[model samples]
Target: MRATAEPAIAVTRQLGRFIATSSWLDIPVDVRREARRTLVHWIACAIGGSTHDTVERAVRAQLAMSNHGNARLFGRRERLVPASAALVNGIASHVLDFDDTQLGATNVHPTGPVASALFALAEIRPLSGAALAHALVLGIEVECRLANAVFRHANRGWHVTGAVGSLGAAAACAKALALEEQQIAFALGTAATQVVGLREMFGSMCKSLHTGRAADNGLTAAMLAAEGYTSADAAVEGPQGYAQVLNGATDLAGVVGALGQRYEISRLSYKPYACGVVMHPTIEACLRAREARPDLSARATAITLRVHPDVLSATGKQSPRTGLETKFSVYHAAAVALVHGIAGEDAFSDAMAVDPHVSAVRGRVRAQPDEAVRKDEVHATFSLPGETIEEHIDHVVGSVTRPMTDADLERKFESLAGEVLGASRCGRLLERCRGFEEISDAREVLAAATA
Candidate 1:
């Protein structure tokens, strides 16, 4: 028998070379626009969540340990070290679970770690808006591709964002610093070893912390690499490395092929609701059902929600006890959307979790998994008095099929960032982000966001 040889592809170093050698010109205009859009969305979420209790406690903890640096978190006057700032801002961006989501590999939040780490570094470095946008796109691409290469969310407990975000963060930080290919490889290696976050932490504050730690660890990895810290260049695919150790996958064809041609950032989707993406469709369907039947609350009956199989695995919580927990509860989402016709931050509050009306509706939600349903699609049925009401959403709002407009995003940003940054400041920040690619210095964003 002839022995077939294994294909050779240097996954980690190749990625590093792409990151190190790629120029801003290599990124297309639309991709850069989407990247800038992502930054705007991320900043809005960060500012909106800056006052969240999670951010409050995390900032206190980091400051208590000595907050000494020039790094700035969104909508906050407090200054922490670069690494601490990344952690605090990352947590703030995701505390409300309203951060932008990219379902590339395993439903990961694409920009939090990369943007958090990059913004932290920008404060200490002379990063231009174009450079920041380029690095941000590359960072997001690396994590999404790496995740696509080794994702096993169906049977595994790894929170893909925490598990794979470090690589993206390290890549972005390294690019922003202009590290050599070898050093970028080392940064990735360091990040590959520090993959953290578990699906079990989904509903808890630890879930947001996973993103913060990934950003902090990734920034540290790049800094260490710049200072000559080294690791196996093939850390991502080597023996007992991230892929094999975590999901037991070895082939990294997805990570290396189409390196800089097809961008994953353009595919990035925004969130209209403040909860998990898994519940968006259900919420949309429920809200539509209410609109279809104005007397929905009076005619409330046996409700059934058929969603993607992943939805059940991810957001199957029936009796969530807290607002954060409610974000992961499909029942609560459907309940609130139908009852209140709104699913904003207040809809998922700690108080809403225990609301009698919301709970009553939540208790009656019958959720089942359907393989045919996609993450952005939902099927709902309501048993009314005279007739059975059914609504099916092929592509929920904010999905790729029906993406939010730039004006829609602006309004969204204004509503969320306005409360914290105020009308004048929020408008300026929004304009700055809209023209981010032309700015000479990225740190100006930090100054503009400072409360």
Candidate 2:
């Protein structure tokens, strides 16, 4: 009689088979629909981020340092090395701070890993849009499952996205390569050893740097696996393995539980703004207050924001001098949104961040955690310029609760893509991604994006 496989072995077998066999058609109709949405969301973020000076500098720096030959940079035809391409593209996807966020698994960002890996592969392979979308599902599954295993670890000191995301990147790359079960298992196993990041780097560019490293390392792992690099198949759950060693816990079953049934990618939150996810609600509040109290500038004495502890911890930028700093600073974003009635790409610019009037308002804005408010909720009360005008924001306007309409997503796409690709190319890119599953070759779609 055949013996039952160990849980780790069973999980590896299941994940390998799932990655090997799962396709767009196998995914539920609703999931396929959401996957398309996620594609649009990630592409918008990448396009929006491509214009950031920081991303440009990083891309150029990588090109100068690395010897890898030319690979396509997102939003442009300029080619850098594969690793550089992954770094630049990954940073672009997350730079605008407008990528999709997974609420469960402690609100980890999902697109960075999948998009970063897939784009690098697209530069070399013949992957289809359907295959890319399916890879996203598998990548998100890997990230969320690993994150779920290490949820407590993130609290202890790890950045779940960076740490678990490395493994996610590897899994997605492996799937995109169509690796065999043993190869996929080994890739995950090898990637477990490479996982690393800390929450201490949250405020700096280094925070996003973690995602870049995950994409790079993940691609490396896939290439190594493809080249016959061998790793222990049970790296995730072996004695003193990834779960116990890195996370201080183990849950092989949880990693594979409801594997085919429950879908995490379908539930991700696509951002409508380019600031921190925690700052979105505050952005909405400031916009609302600006609309309501046009003359309250003199009346507004102070603005108080009651937010979740996590938000305060994650996005509480006390004083921002640059757009990047402002992205991490709730105080800056809230102040700008209320004063200007909008927080667009330019809102976080150095000119705006250093504006004396903006600084004055930012000084008055205070973010504190209140247990009564939901973790995702941002309640804002404003003291007006003429009279004290107060509003309680029950939720962010463009959140999953009050999602951005398809029209809103289109507008966001146009705003981001048009900056680099022009309106016509942007429209073509959006149409191609929306109908991604039907494309025979993804390069044609990618060509449209940059054409």
Number of the top lDDT candidate: 1
Please give, for residues 268-312, the per-residue lDDT of candidate 1 as tens digits.
789999999989988988888898886785577789988888887
What TM-score, to 2 decimals, does candidate 1 have?
0.97
- Model 1, residue 272: what's the lDDT? 93
Candidate 1 total steric clashes: 0
In candidate 2, what are the lDDT values of residues 333-368, reduced to their tens digit?
Answer: 888887777687788777987988778888888887
TM-score of each: 0.97, 0.91
Residue 64 of model 2, lDDT score: 78
lDDT of each: 0.89, 0.76
- Regions of model 1 farther than 4 Å from truth: 1-7, 152-155
Q: What number of clashing residue pairs does each candidate have, in the order they appear?
A: 0, 13
